[model samples]
Target chain A: MKLKSTAALIGSIIGASLLAATPAHAQNVKIGLLSGITGPIAAMAPPMIAASQLAVAHVNEQGGIGKGGKLEVVVGDSACNPQNATDAATKAVNIDRAVGIVGPACSGAVLAAANSVAVPAGALLITASGTSPQITSINDKDLVFRTVPSDDYQGRALARTLKGRDITKVAVAFLNNDYGKGLAEAFKAEFESLGGTIAGYSGHEGSKASYRSDLAELAKGGADTLVIFDYGDGTGLTILRQALENNFFKTFIGADGMKSDAVIRELGADNLGTFFTSSPVGEASSSLESFNKAFTAAGQSPDAIFTTTSYDAAFLMALAIEKAGGDNAKLAESLRAVSSAPGEPIMAGEWAKAKKLIAEGKDIDYKGAAGDHEFDKNGDVPGTYAFFKVSGGTYESLGEMK
Target chain B: MELIGLANYAIFMGILIGIYALLALGLNIQWGLTGLFNAGIAGFFAVGAYASAIITSPHVAGRVGGFELPIVVGWMGAIVFAGLIAWPIGKVCLRFRSDYLAIATIGVAEIIRLVIKSEDWLTGSSRGITGIPRPFGELDYVASQLAYLGLVIAAVAVVYFLLERQLKSPWGRMMRAIRDNEAAAAAMGKQIEARRLQAFIFGAAVMGLAGALFVHFNRSITPEAIDPMIATFLIWIMLILGGSGNNRGAILGAIVIWLLWSVSEMITDRLPTDVALQAKYIRIFVVGLALQLVLRFRPEGILPEEQARQTAR
Candidate 1:
């Protein structure tokens, strides 16, 4: 009885606060954004949220998504917790009345909220950062779409590169979280299936500052090619690189988590031959460079690996909506219409032509900053992977991970 | 902008203080009344939420114990579950040293959390349970929040007053005696363990009640919602700052902290968009600094507990 009365009181108070805004909100087309604004994945997510909002802003400036004259974004902060993700997604879709969700960056977060809310509601979930293969493999609902490729895709690409190098065995270590575990499992499955052997496999806690003990155990396995599946940050990768200084191993392999300039900066030139596979960041032109310059001018770290990819995901999503006569359902159907090869060139520069082609009833392909993303069955982009080798201060494309 | 009025400010602060009051009252019973130190208060609070959620959830196995029962009955179930669970935990840990009890309880907290996370059948694994029918969602969100705040504040005040009254009676004296020296109090023909158990169970029940309230207000529940960082630390901070054993102090500290948090968010919201974006990092720094400053400046907290004194005959 006490709780019911208290709830009754809270309801009245909140009603009074929101009564003023209802009329204003009724006019806008709301897009629900579920992102990890705090906790473990916050480092990668906040910027993505900003870029997404910017995308909404740009689209609104050009023209609204559908019949709505303006686009409004309703952001739900999941804080990288699965439970919060579930609640936030419901509130976003049901209460906030948002048409689609462009978030839930963490793989576990995506899984938590996707099944009951987004998929059931028939609202599209376009994740900008999650890379777990289980996401796409869960089912064929088609409502769940990802801008990033699965860990399986990236892992296989890396394993193929190992094949090119004639590497037979590698000692692998990964963070125990969903992202790390997914990549490690994929790398192991693909690498071993191709007649390769894992010399060692161990999981490490990412919160710790020292991984010397974990590395020492991996080192004892005596594998020359060390595969690091963890987010090789200042703490973990520093220990790995120091292991080389201590003569533990010469070359190291990294999955997408370690594929960053930060990793290169941490390891230095001595660990220069280190290879990692991530989604291909397509060739940068003067236009892209200018965008980078503008990003930095606006007081953001322009060189962060995900910023460009996030920017591209927005454009691609909007382009799809545009091509589908600006309907979410039509855009979802037209997602397959976005091809990479042998069809119309729908690169970022050719948006005007693609727009014309869409009007002309032609199949419009979408190639954005993340590369020519021809989504295969299950929304997994069958895009080529780029292998980055740290040389000097920057990453030189060694070759395709394939 | 100033005309926005501080009604929400007052309302939000009042409710949060009410919640802290609830938590602090429970902790007071365990620590102040019974002399049992439970470091894992958050764990039980989480359990209470999950229990109520699993019972009332329309989605979980079709809400078997569900029925979307009125919030009061669901809350009663939660409190009873919390009390029952506390009985066993207190039995095993109550006889040990205070420090040992703390460690054991913390372990229990962790075990509960892992169970909640992995147990797909009950807690829905990591997917969590959503679409909870808020007690009066017929009124919608904003109305619901206000209703919750009012409900929580009244509950806290009533609980605190009742607790104060009970403590002032023969029962209160027995608790104080047990708190000061358990052996002496026991030698005085007091059933020390029974008294302690009574206090402990009562506290856990209150925590259970609080959890149900929070779960319904949020209109969702998940295993991950049991984060001890917020639940545990915040409770400890409230008790310590508000002066443990003082219900009023606890209530004050809760409201003050909630106000600080909400006001900071509002301030951050009003900042220039570009700077506001970058201010996210700065916000964490500022919160940390505030905590440190509060601890340093007011070690006894804002409202110190009024010590009991016996009149000279």
Candidate 2:
């Protein structure tokens, strides 16, 4: 008797979910906005979602999708883990019938969602912040793409920028996680290949109180510059503080992970005169400027970590959907056609113009807010990066990295 | 098209439910039948996942595997490796009373997670292992999903029937006796330590198999997938809610909890866009609330253990 009642309740819940799965407006073109809205990177998710929503708003406000159809977005919380990510992706693909999916944010989430749901279902996936080099090797059949450059690109670019500035020798300390390890390895390879010397290189676990011993060990190599590849708000702060207090290194360098406002807030801008970091920036500044203005007007900070890439991903998804004419099978090809070169250039937020161009059967190239997203064969972007230094309580760009 | 989509979604949910059911059944063996509090399900799960992934995946340049064995061999490897890893942990920590065992197991799980996160060559570190082969992965999306679901259901049925048979035998009665009163069982000439160790290893090996199933289904394994919250605590909730000592109840609990966790998002997605995003957070709260209500009202669980004498009658 008890079991019967429980079964009835489960039946009703499943039934209700089925009822809710039906689309309200059948003509509306749906897209899935998958993000880590509730887990490890919860704080970063809201802005990224908002940025994607902004792109949808631009599409709907300016003629929407094909044949007077509205562009609709179904937001799914990936929760920054594979369990939630695959679940979310399944629902987005099967229930919402999204033509394309914008993100699952984290690298691990991206892999699981793409492999288990999106790729198998033949749905297009464009993640904004999945930066793992491993993603470059997914036998995806051209269905998986990301707006953010892989960590490999940034590390190599930073290495080149450092070498260009005549920094011949340096010591490195990295956090023992995927982000830090990936950047450190790529930087080591590029820097060494460029005939630069890495005097000392070590990876440390995060949140240790004192790195004085590790710093001393690194300083034993007698290098002045120390390149740190960890989050600025995390153990990187501790390492930087210890290095400065002991005068272990005269110069300090960081990857994008270390370019946090928390560092300046805690360590003070005055003390960071010799500190420098390299971060991905828009190749064409106008594209970034337009996104910044629109995002700011929408009451969101355009400078939030992956906001630019998030916008680009959503906008590019919209362009592809338009180009494909709602045919799900052609989204992958359409995405490449719309994002790659050999056509009229489309800037961020110029949805109506791109739509018109697509209608006229002309090819279009999207100059994204994060970079010109000319996807390589692996659907990976070789991102444009800029060097920055702390000045006047904020980071000021020192020019584009070669 | 709509019906087909629903079928696809249902198949996906069914596959996940089957995986969680296996985990819950494994938990039932330890906590229900054997009176152990092994809080580190994620550790065993990770061991199983990485073991299977390495055994079956094509050799990468850096990692410690190029075995490229058959899928069945990978599953067998997962079971063996998980049991092998559990033997030492159980020998060391099974002596602790329930809560202490829980604490020790939690620490063990954390250590395992950190190792998987940091060890690059062994488990691909945080980048994770991809390119795992699925049994029917080359089929069309619907056919492949249906085939995987069928595979999962078959595995569940096999585990379920085996567990049911084991729980009905003399060994099952002895385990229950030891669980209800350790002192009395020890007085009766039962080797309490060895029995508990055996149950722990058995439960962990089952969890490891579930991990293998999960990795192959998803075609990838990451440290994130082995997070204690989802991989460990979620299984515990299913076992406790389904009635820890009841194998059928364990399966039921997995179905109930997973449906609630997943379907709640779909229901909430119908709300206005802004509220829908905030409502996503409520799904966690809803799961927590269900557990609390169950604990307060149905502490013995939805399908409480049937008394042995009553069952015999």
TM-scores of the candidates in the order shown: 0.69, 0.94
Tens-place lDDT per residue, model 1, A1-402, is 999999999887777766754445225556677677766667777667766665666667654544444666666666675545655576566555666777777766676566545664566677777676657753437877776777766777777778778999888887655566666777888889999988888776567766677777887877887887766553446656666767777777776567666766766755666554454555434435544654666567655645666666666666666666645566567666754455576654344566567667877666665666666667766545777776677766676665
DockQ metric for all predictions: 0.10, 0.47
Alpha-carbon local distance difference test for all models:
0.67, 0.92
Model 1 alpha-carbon miss at residue B15, Å: 13
Native-referenced TM-scores of chain A, all candidate models: 0.82, 0.90
Local accuracy of candidate 2 as per-residue lDDT tens digits, A1-402? 999999999788778867875545446888899999997778779999999999999999999988888988999999989999999999998888877899999888999999999999999999999988988888898999999999999999999999999999999999876678889999999999999999999988877999999999999998999999988867889999999999999999998878888889999999999999998999878999999999999999786788999999999999988898857789999999999998999999999899999999999999999999999999999988999999999999999998
Clash list (residue pairs), candidate 2? none
Instruction: List runs of model 1 lying over 4 Å from the truth.
Output: A1-38, A46-78, A82-99, A111-124, A132-144, A156-165, A274-303, A320-345, A349-363, A371-384, B1-37, B42-177, B180-184, B191-227, B237-267, B281-313
Go through the candidates in order and give the C-alpha RMSD of each one to the true structure. Answer: 7.8, 4.2
Candidate 1: residue A389 lDDT (0-100): 70
What shift in Å separates residue A106 of candidate 2 from its native position after superposition? 0.8
DockQ of 1: 0.10
Query: What tens-digit string does per-residue lDDT give for candidate 1 at B1-313?
Result: 1112244334434545666678878888787666788888887887788778767766546223456666677787888898998899878777776888889989988877777655546765444556555565455334544776779978887788889998788998889889988889989999987788888888988887777776765555654456776677667766766666677777766666545544454465346755655554554565456667768996655665455423312
TM-score of 1: 0.69
